[model samples]
Target chain A: MEDLDKELVRRARLGDKDAFAAIYEHNLPRIYRFIYFKTANRATAEEITQEVFLAALRAIPRYHDEGFLVSSWLYEIARNKVIDFYRSKKSDISIDEELEERPELTSTDFVKTMETKIEADKLKNLLKKLPEDYQNIILLRFVEDLSNEEVAHSLGKSLGAVRVLQHRALKALRKLVE
Target chain B: MTKERIHNLFDKAKEIKPSEGFLSRTRARLYEEPLDHPRSQFFFESLHFGATQAGIYATAACAAAFIIYMSSSISVNEKQSVAMKRTEQIEDYKIDVTLKDARYYKEVAPNVFVVVSK
Candidate 1:
């Protein structure tokens, strides 16, 4: 995967639109899922996800391999875009407002379906309520399925530190889950 | 807590994949718009190689200039020091014999000579 990413990055650096497209296809889902979970809104997630990819595309010509995965660089951009989104909006409550504005509740669904959606919503809210560090650890580790080493690189933490953080994050998440 | 349970909770949590046309929409937006590269990345990409080549040429030229300057200055200094040493030698010279007893007098410099007795 690393070699493949290197190849794609090399091609992209040479102004290969096809290679840039491949990179977009490769990283889109993970970036979108990350933004979705972070913002808890599809529209905002889509917007920021697009912005992140566009940012990556523009930045690709200068991409130098720094002995880490190319995805690490993209993840760094995605994380920053999320941060920037919140900063420019000047309110974290906008996410909750987005949650309230979603049309999921107005659907004419059965009680069981509504209950399941409510449970999912509750889980999302709980996940969001965890401290930012723990939230990022959980999402990157379990949701994104990144390996511990990758998580360490993505989060700029040591491997042992990521392990300890993941352990604590899971414990806290478990308490919230229960 | 069991890793399985944690995994299950993560799996059960809201898995909000982007809408169906999300990738296409993103691709269209990406293709339609001209991407504005960050200033730093732009400067690095556009200028680095050219700048490096220019730097190499500049350094080589400077080194050549320095060598030329040092060699010319050193030659001048060497010529001056040689003339000074010659003058000192002339001043330090002493004759132990008079001109009447001298057998051979060889003129080696203007108005100056070394006498040798046979």
Candidate 2:
């Protein structure tokens, strides 16, 4: 998969519109799904997802391997766009001396995101019964389909720390499930 | 959660497919729009001759502006000093002229033009 992605990336980088179209067709859903998970609003998610691909198109010539996956890079762009959207929304709330910090995704936000995930749908109210950090770990681990290493990398936690968190998260989830 | 339960959810979740025509539309959009070259790369690391030339021009313009600013500052200082010197010379000339007039009057014989108009 990585090889195929790289091939498309190379062609896209070289201005091959057809090859890039194939890549766009292949990855748009996954990308859209990722963005949808983050934003939790269909309209906002769709906008940012399209922006990510457009940004990737513009940045293709300058894209460099920064020890990050192309998808990760795309996600980073989406993340920034999401942040901007939230910021714009916040400004509309009322004028103030300083902009409010992005409302850190509360348990409510998590539930909104996981409302569709497997047993999670039936377990929404139950999931909230778990601790925030545990919920964070479970979401990143399963719904996000991130590897343990990738989770650690994304979270800036050591492998041992992530492992410990995962253990605790699963135990807590089990209690909720029971 | 039981494996059976987990598998049940997974299977059901996976069935909630993404929108149809998404890929086709995206492909058409991708082909419809040509890729753009990022402009910020020139700021970070650009090798284009045009970009390099723009950098060189910017550097040269900044350097030239600095030189002009410094030269103008120096010229202002020099003009101020020159003006001060001229003022002092005028004062000195006035003093000299006073002294010369006194000497010329003193050198005149006391008897000369001695019409005592007491």
Candidate 3:
């Protein structure tokens, strides 16, 4: 994996379009899957995924060979992008608080919408029950499929620390699920 | 019934693949962005890479300058203290004027008072 990344990076440094394409192909699944879990909806995930790739394209050049595992580097970048998205989104909600103006619903298709809304609310509440750090860890580990080592590298933590956090995070989620 | 449901939820979440057209749309966006060659490639890299190097250099230079500055000040202090001690020693001498005045008076008034040399 490291070798392939190095190869792509080398080609990419030389401004090889196909190499960049190869990187995109290799990474899109991981990026998309990670984002999908953060946002439980499909459309938002897709938009964030697009933004991730665009960001990657813009950032590929300054990547140094400071023993950075490329996948971890990419994962870190994606993590930051996701955080930025959520921050912007949260701030936007605070701006107008426009959603509060809606009256009691009388529209058709309301039952299905209400069901999804309830489930979403329940899921969000369960997510909130975990510490923010644990939530981030679980999202990266189980949902993003990044290895503990990768997560540690991305988060700039010791392997033991990441492992401990992952353990605690899984336990916390188990409480929520059960 | 168990925590497996959440674990399974995560698993199911992973299995929920993106739509098939995802890549094509991605490719379109990719192409729309300059592939591996854009003005920003230079702007971002030069700005970031240059700034990192500059920061490290600046920190090291400042440290060196501080050391040099401190050592020079210490030596100056040492020299100043030595000069201060010398000034103190020179200033400690208090000359008495009585003996010299008396000698002059005797020499001028020899007719009135004889001064014997002892």
Candidate 4:
């Protein structure tokens, strides 16, 4: 994975459009999922995901051959983009807006939607109720299936610190779910 | 929440996928953006590119001229100091000696000879 990322980034640095697009495609799901959990709004998540990739696109030239994975760098950008989104909104006003102003559902469609997506929807709302750090740890660890070391790399924390955070985050998440 | 519930939640969450058309739309946006090129490339392509490059060259020329001016001033100061030291040496010479039919008077000041060679 590291070698593949290095090759992709090397091509990307040299202005390979296809290479960059490949990077975008490779990281899109994880970044989108992260943002989706944070914002709990598909539109906002999609928009922020776009912003993250564009920002990454613009920054690819300045990327050095530091031994970090490209995914790690992408995650860092996603994290900052989420922060900027919140900072600009001043609160979760958009989340509330999305919940409040969603188009009314027909009865037949409502039942279908609930049956299919209820657990995911509940998970999103419960994840949002936790503190930001706990939410991130839980999502990255369990949902993304990143190891503790990978989580530490993305979060810039020590491995032991990540473990402690993961434990606390799971505890907090349990409380929220109950 | 129990550990089992937590696991179940994560399992459901992991099933969440991005909406359709995301890849195509994003790819279009990427193609539309000129982000693949370096900023300086655009800086050179824009109308202001020439003007900015010319400005940079002109500033470099001015800097070169300033350095030359400083060095030339320093050289002039060096010459003046050397001349002053010559005068000081002349002030130190007070002895006059005549040897082998050549008379020597040490010069103490300009146009005042302490040593005269004949």
Q: lDDT by residue for model 2 over A1-178, one digit each (tens)? A: 7777786776667566766667667666656755544443444555677777777787887777655446656655665676687777733222111112223446775454345443433543444577655654565576557677766665556779889998987777665555
For A1-178, candidate 4 gives per-residue lDDT tens digits of 8899998997787677899999988888888888888885777888889999898888987987668778878888899999898888744444333323334556785565455357777888887778888888988889998878778888888999889988998888777767
Q: Give a tens-digit lDDT track for model 1, residues B1-118.
A: 4556566556755354554477887888877756554457556765775788899999999999999999999999999898677645654674444665333222333334444433
Q: Say what the interface RMSD of candidate 3 is.
A: 6.1
The 10 consecutive residues of candidate 3 chain B with the worst lDDT sum are B109-118
Residue clash pairs of candidate 1: none
lDDT of 2 at A43: 49
Clashes of each: 0, 0, 0, 5
Query: With candidate 4 superimposed using the best TM-score fit, by how many Å does residue A168's alpha carbon deviate from the native?
Result: 0.7
What tens digits encode model 1's per-residue C-alpha lDDT throughout A65-167? 8877777788889888988998888444343333343435434433544454455565568778788778888888887888888888878889999999888
Preferred candidate (lDDT higher): 3 or 4? 4
lDDT (Cα, 0-100) at A81 in candidate 1: 94
lDDT of 1: 0.72
| Tens-place lDDT digits, model 3, residues A1-178 | 7888887886676566678788888877777766655664556667788887777777776667756557677677777777888788743222111123223334553454445444444544576688766866886787677878778887778899999999998888777777
Interface RMSD after interface superposition, model 4:
4.5
lDDT of 3 by residue, B1-118 (tens): 5666676666555544455577777887787776555566646755776799999999999999999999999999999898666445434532233666546544543333323343
lDDT (C-alpha) at residue A15 in model 1: 63
Ranking by TM-score: 4, 1, 3, 2
Q: lDDT tens digits, residues B1-118, model 2?
A: 4645644543433332234444455556666665463445433443464578898999999999999999999999999888667556544554333544545533542222222222
| Chain A accuracy as TM-score for every candidate | 0.81, 0.60, 0.73, 0.83
Q: In candidate 4, which residue ranges exceed 4 Å CA deviation?
A: A90-116, B36-118
* Superposition error at A26 for model 3 (Å): 1.6
- The Cα local distance difference test for each model comes to 0.72, 0.58, 0.67, 0.76
